[model samples]
Target: MSKRVLDVGNCGPDFSSIKAFLTKNFDCTLDQAHGMEDSLAALREGNFDLVLINRKLDRDYSDGIEILREIKADAVLKDIPVMLITNHAEHQDAAMELGAKRGFGKLEFGNPETLEKLQPILG
Candidate 1:
């Protein structure tokens, strides 16, 4: 079966590349949830192998650390791998400390936030 990815950024050109790449490279199914709460709710109700979280969100919420904390705190969702996509490598240490599988800079993803490096983690 195709692996499931919870993309928390919704639909946008900025994220379109990653979405397209995920399908093209991994042949995975992506379920896009627009907000923090929605993504959290989905995690509670369903099972997802990984989560690709964008640096920003629909609202003014760009804080992925707290969300990462909450996810790790949850018994059911703690094991789900979470990857943070950002333009700053500075967040790498902090995010990893909070249980994020990894953090990537916008440039790291090149034209998209999807990278082959994600294969092992998501696989």
Candidate 2:
């Protein structure tokens, strides 16, 4: 089955890596969100299989965490699997504590670990 993914953050190499990986492996569509507002709008407007939020967005890194919290708290959005993307382990823990499905390290985007970590969500 096809899937929908909402990718929230600035356009960067990490985003590229993720897009490439998803395109090559899954029959999915991507909706890009450049900031928290856009991310929230996308979540409300569409049903996504997964959400990938950057540890930091166009304005600030901490904004992503706030976005994560909002997603988890929303009755409708809470069901979507959310992953926080960052290279920092500390940030990952914070995201997890906020109810993120998983913390994804941007550095691991091109590695096999990315695929492994994404398996459950993708499946």
Candidate 3:
């Protein structure tokens, strides 16, 4: 079965790279959302196996943590696995503290460790 992923707040090039990497490595499909409202709406309407939220939205420079928080707080959406895409350990820790899975940065997109982290979810 192909998994479905919602990628939130990523810019065009980033989303393209992510989509390519995921498609090449796993049986999955990726969808994009530019900000919190869009992300939440997509999550509510779709069956996504995982969510990848950018640390700062390219669209408005809004904090992606707020989006993560929203998802984690909702009863129905809270169970869906979420990962914050960032290079900063502090930000990663913050997301993890709020129930997000450890996410990889854009710089680490093609790393083996990233594949390892995603395997259980997307494999």
Candidate 4:
């Protein structure tokens, strides 16, 4: 069976690339959430093996961090692997402290390095 990924943030070109790469290389289904409400709704609806949270939503980077905290605080969803994607590497430490599996730069998506880093989580 294919794993499911909840991509919470912009579902535009950036997410499209990540989705295309992941679907083509890995056996997984990727769904998107435009913002916090949509993300919460999606989480309530089904199970997701992983969550890809972008640093910016429609507004700013803080929204993603807020959603990340919510997911970590929830008993039901806390166990899911959450990865924070941002342009700055500085966000990595904060994301990890909030229970994220890892934080990767937006530029890393669709590349072999990111793919390799995702192996353990995907497995």
- Highest lDDT scorer: 3
State candidate 4's TM-score: 0.90
Error of 4 at 119 (Å): 0.9
lDDT (Cα, tens digit) per residue for candidate 4, span 1-123: 789999888658878888887887789999998788889889989989999998878545446888999999998889998988886767877889898977577777756878887887674
Of 2 and 3, the candidate ranking higher by TM-score: 3
Clash tally for model 4: 0
User: Which structure is stronger by TM-score: 2 or 4?
Assistant: 4
TM-score of each: 0.84, 0.88, 0.98, 0.90
- CA shift of 101, model 2, Å: 1.9
In candidate 3, the residue pairs with backbone N, CA or C atoms under 3 Å apart (3 or more residues apart, or in different chains) clash, namely none
- Error at 30, model 1, angstroms: 0.9
Residue 55 of model 2, lDDT score: 75
- Cα lDDT of model 3 by residue, 3-117, tens digit: 9999999899999999999999999999999988889999999999999999999999999999999999999999999999999999999999999999999999768999999
Per-residue accuracy of model 2 over 1-123 as CA lDDT, tens digit each: 889999888466667778887878778878798887788899999889999988778556556888899899999889888988888888888888888866667567677777787778775
Instruction: List per-prediction Cα lDDT, in the order shown.
Output: 0.74, 0.81, 0.95, 0.83
Cα distance off (Å), candidate 2, residue 52: 0.4
Candidate 3 weakest lDDT stretch, 10 residues:
102-111
For every candidate structure, what is the RMSD over all alpha carbons to the true structure, in angstroms?
2.5, 1.7, 0.6, 1.7
Give residue 78's lDDT in candidate 4 (0 to 100): 91
Query: How many pairs of residues collide in each model?
Result: 0, 1, 0, 0
**Winning candidate number (TM-score):** 3
lDDT of 1 by residue, 1-123 (tens): 788888776347656766776777775887877776888999888878888777666456677666777889998899999987776677766788888976675566554444655878655
